[model samples]
Target chain A: MKIVTCIKQTFDTEAKIVVGGDGQISDEGVNMILNPYDEYAVEEAIKTKEKDGGEVVVVTVGGDKAQEALRYSLAMGADRAVLINDPALEKADSHAVSVALAKLLSDKEAGYDVIFAGKEAVDDGAAQVPSRLAAKLDLALANVVVAVELADGKATVTREIDGGTEELEMALPALISAQKGLNEVRYPSLPGIMKAKRKPLDVVSLADLGLSAEDVASKVEMVSAELPPARKAGQKLTGEVDEVVAKLVELLKNEAKVI
Target chain B: MSIVVCAEQRDGKLSKVTFEALSEGKRLAAASGETLKALVIGSGVAACADELKKYGADEIAVADNEALAAYTTETYAAVLAAYIAQESPALVLMGHSTVGRELAARAAGIADCGLVSDCVAIESADGDYLFKHPVYAGKAIGTFKISGATRLATLRPNVFAIEESDGAGAVVDFAPEIPAAKVTVKAVNKVSGDRPELTEADIICSGGRGLGGPEGFKLIEDLADSLGAAVGSSRAAVDAGWREHAAQVGQTGKVVSPNLYIASGISGAIQHLAGMGTSKYIVGINKDGEANIFNVADYGIEGDLNKIIPALVEKLKEA
Candidate 1:
């Protein structure tokens, strides 16, 4: 069994968002880390390898700084990493990213038994890459997956839906996106971190993957980006507990009309 | 050219978001002077055609088949992609839902077009359609313009209004070839509750780690019952195993914008705020007066949630 996990680097969840004068999001002074959801995918991939006696390889599409995210995955027990970085990908939309990934995975030598990815990246929250990649590669896909079990060349997956969970079964060579509650991720150990520094990490350009600027050109253009309006300061109610509760209820009914 | 709205139905009932999508599609079509078509694909879903007509769709196409009784990404994407290929609509609309998020991208990929998901607004400026959506987990907004012959977008639920107008349209039967499913559905386990879904709820009552334990959710449930609202939990509460992940509200969880949001015993992490910050009116009840939840709340009650929530529940019941 061979497993491939896709990951991305995003601003730290606690980082403040700022739009610069250039109409672009400013990354200055912002701490960047591997996306939180991708951690779950990496963890699940490694766990599957540990049990199934195979290798876990991590893949990412970003700039030179993305190697930090690949190294983080390596430190978590992935065998190696592949980073596809190029100027053509700077403004790539979900379609372009998927095309690049499909090119890489479609190579004759890049045989994979299963693929894993986070349900969505926190930065864009597009939640389209996995499905789009699956479509391009013609692979079975299960999104927002919580539990998975492999047996007899088939995988049973449970995913979260609108009001409940749905169970599905797919053959091997399928793609699964990790949702939260899939598993608790483990922290990289000191020995693992030491070994990760020596792990093989290959950085390639889009041209190396048989893709050109025209091939992966973004279909969607970013017209503009801006920060949301700041929320107004709230009115604090102070008094006896019962009085405040009564006042709040009245306001909800008469003022807000929500009740 | 026409605007095509994919009407989603489950177990023979059309979803509320479908109506919202149709309403938006109708407006966009009227603005562009194009036809509006509603496509319904499911087992025994032809009955939805009449309802689509009432919502101002100029044409309704139903592809009723037993194979589509349960949603399999491949089959549904194939069906929708084939429809788009034949219709060649200028724009396609659907609800940004579990099914929509899973199907729209694959359909767009097959149709070889551009897609924007979870859009809060769609506007036409100088004859170009601009899609505005929250990026960086609701901390910022990004406006996108698709440079494609045909574009697709998913409208966030509850953000768009649903309007009804008496419309006469032709009902057509579409018989696109459904592809073989790569995945098979085995079972479905629905959460047992009559409360509205978090995304569709008009009001929501949420709990956090400050509630102490899973038992504390009892109070939150009582409050929600009184207001006919949905129940939500902060990531801390879900991580602590006090609530299911489905009920979690955060950047990694569900993003919602209900009419009223009550945050009890929540200290409001930035991630949690990213999910519910856009809600219309927020009420925070926490012991810490300086909790971050208070910053974005419309009304703040500084006290113990254990006492305040129960009192508020009683008052709501009376009101």
Candidate 2:
């Protein structure tokens, strides 16, 4: 059994996001970490390998800084890491990113029995890359998986839907995106961190993957950006709970007209 | 030319977001000089066609199949892909609900087209469409322009107004040969709640970690019941095991734009605000005046939720 996990780096959830003067995102003085959800994917991939005696590979697409995310995955227990980085690929949309990933994974050297990824990157929240990559690879895919059991060339997956849960069975050579509450992620030990520094971290380009500039062209273009408008302050009702409740009732009936 | 809208239904009932999608589809099709068509795929959903027709759809296409009774990425994608491949509509529309989140990209991927998800607004300029959506957890808005043979977009629920109408239109039977789903849905445990869905509710009352424990939601639920509103919770409440994930309203949770949103004991994170900030009216109740929830709240009541909620529930019950 061979497993490959897709990962990304994003701003820490607590980081204050600010738009620069040029309408581009400014992450100055902010901490960057592997996307929180991807941690679940990496943990699941490592755990599966620990149980089934297989190799785990972590893959990422971004600039040089993204290699940190790859190393973090390696530190967590992945055997090797692959970085698909180029200046031109920085602003690529989800579609282009999927194309590049599919191209890279299709390599005979990158043969994988199963693939895992976070349900969505916390930054873009697109939730499209892994599914689209599965489509491109022509593999079965299940997103937002909470539990997975792989055996006999098949995977029984449990996922959350609108109201409840659904148990799905898919053959191997499948793709799954990890949702939260999947598992508790473990921190990298000092020995693991030291070993990760010596792990095989291969950086590849689009040309290396047999992809052209035209093949990975972004379909969605960012036209503009701005901070969301500030919400106006609402009137505060003081006094006892009864008074506040009385006032709220009157306001809902007369002003808001909701009740 | 036509603009295709995927109408979502569950258990033989149409989702409100489905109507919202059709409304936007009508506007976009009119702007682009394209006909609006609604496509529903499920078991026994032929009756849903009339609702789409009344909401301004020019044509309603139903792919009634037992295999599609519940959503699986493969079956829905294949059926929708088959329809879009044959029709080649200028634009494809769906609601950015759980089903849409799973179905939209797969269909677009199979159709070999581009998609923008969770769009709050769509603008047409010279027949080209530009979509506005939130990124970076709703702290900033990004406008996207997609260029492809066919365009796909999922509209955020409650962002678009549903058009009023009383006219039923034509229905066309679309029998596509759906392939066997690679993934099988064994069972579905539907939520047992009489309150409206969080995404489609007119009024929402959400609680947060300030309630201290799971019991805090009791007050929240009581107020919600009295006002005929849906119950919501911040991610903190959900993560703390105070509420179900389905009731979570935040960046990772369901985005809601209800007519009235009441936040109790919630210290708003940007992620939570991103989900509900678009709401028409926001009321915040927290002991701390500095909670970020107050920043976006239209009405701020400084008090303890434990007392305020019960008192409010009593007042409503009396009224």
Candidate 3:
């Protein structure tokens, strides 16, 4: 089984999200981090390869600097890296990006039994790619997958819904968007990082995927940026623990009405 | 032009969030001087059309197919996108639900519009809609204008009150131009358990690092169980391995706006506050009076939650 994992690069969670004059995110001088959710995807892909004896390819749709994110993958343990490096694909919305990804996978004729991605991207947190890719490629998809296993030409997965999580059994060659706690993300060992540098990293362009700039133009654009208002700082009560607890109960019942 | 609101239904009943979307549609519709319409889709979900009409919809589009019998992104997006195109509503209001987020992202792509997910506030100023959403895991908020004639957005549940009205409405069975077969649902596997819906739970009890470990959290769980509330945790609690990230309510985790929120040992970092600052009532339990959580909480108890929680739970049982 060949597994393809989609990893996205986002500003580190701690970075100050400076909205530049153009209303786009200012990435200059900010520490970059892989989307937290994608760690589970990478982990799942490596685990899949370990279980079913297949190669795992880590791919992304980002700028040239995004190669560092791929390097992080190498440090951890992905077998290969494919960066769709073209000015055309940058800032492509989930829809256009998914179309480009589907076309890329098909053009390569990459035989894979399963494709994995995080439940959603961390930057926009749109959570769109996995399902949209499934629609374009016409494959089965399960979003919010917690448990996944492949066997005998089929894959069994468990995911979440409004009520709760349910188990599912479907045939192979499907897409799944993963969530956290599915597995523990592993760290890159010294040897893993060393080997990652020598590992094959394929760079694909939109032209090579047989796609055009127009096909990947974002339909929606960000107009402006502003911050949320701060909550009014409240007063704190002082007393013994018992008095504080008693006073707290009175406030909740009388003022907050939570009881 | 009229507006369309998608009312989500589950277990053969309309989700309370349906009212929230309708409430927003009601506001936007009234502002634009247009009637509000509702587009509803589910398996065996058409019976809910009449109830939706009373909420302010002038017309309801009911699409019931076995394929849609379950909530899959493929089936629901195609179904919703086709309906939005047919109606050409000025605004589309949807809940920021698990299904709503997935469906909204796809629909925005199909309709060629932008979506502001997990929004806390939507304001109409100078004939443009301004949306407020939390960023940086919840320490700060970002407001932006969606530049499009057809504005589509998903509202965070419970942030805005679900508007109510005595509007008269009717059901209209309309077929979309696109065939349902245009999309395929290869498989669906949902998690099934007795967990309450996190976003909509009126009362949420969350634990944090102060709880020590998984065993210590059982007391909080017991309190949550007695209150019949959803369970949540702070980033420290999740990092400490006391709870799952799904159960985390903070900036990096799920943002929630329940009516009543209880935090034990949560110091109320900006990220944690961003996720739940919109909660109407908050109770904090910690030993520090200067904890940031007290800044937003309606009430505070500077004490050990381990001793305070069992008593609170017992008090509730007596009441």
By lDDT, is 2 or 3 better? 2
Supply the TM-score for candidate 3: 0.89
What DockQ values do the models have? 0.83, 0.68, 0.34
In model 3 chain A, the worst 10-residue window by lDDT is A219-228
Query: Which segments of candidate 3 are over 4 A away from where they belong?
Result: A19-25, A257-259, B108-113, B124-128, B144-150, B175-196, B225-228, B239-241, B269-271, B288-292, B295-298, B314-319
Candidate 3's residue-wise lDDT over A53-158, tens digit each?
A: 8788888898888888888887788888898988887667676778788887776846888888998766776677776677667676677877887889877887
Residue pairs with clashing backbones, model 2: A234-B298
What lDDT tens digits, residue by residue, belong to model 2 across residues B1-319?
7889998888888888889988888787768888888899999998898777788887889999888887788788889899999889888999887778768888877777889888999987887899988887777888888997688999888889898553346799999998887877777766736888788899999999888899888888888898889999999988887887778888777778999999999998878987898898898999998888777776788877877888888888899
Per-residue lDDT value at B96 in model 3: 83
Q: Estimate, for each residue in A173-198, the C-alpha lDDT of model 2 and write its tens digit.
A: 99999988788899999999999999
Worst lDDT 10-window in candidate 2 chain A: A102-111
Best by TM-score: 1
**Can you write out model 1's per-residue Cα lDDT over B74-124, one digit (the tens) per residue?**
988988998999999989999989888889998988887899999999986
Model 3: residue A190 alpha-carbon error in angstroms: 1.2
Instruction: RMSD for all candidates, in order, please.
Output: 1.3, 1.8, 3.2
- What's the C-alpha lDDT at position A76 in model 1? 90
**Residue B191 of model 2, lDDT score:** 72
After the best TM-score superposition of candidate 2, give how far the Cα of residue A255 lies from its true spot, in angstroms. 1.9
> Deviation in angstroms for B85 in model 3?
3.5
| lDDT (0 to 1) per candidate | 0.90, 0.86, 0.76
User: Which parts of model 2 have CA positions greater than 4 angstroms off?
Assistant: A27-29, B166-168
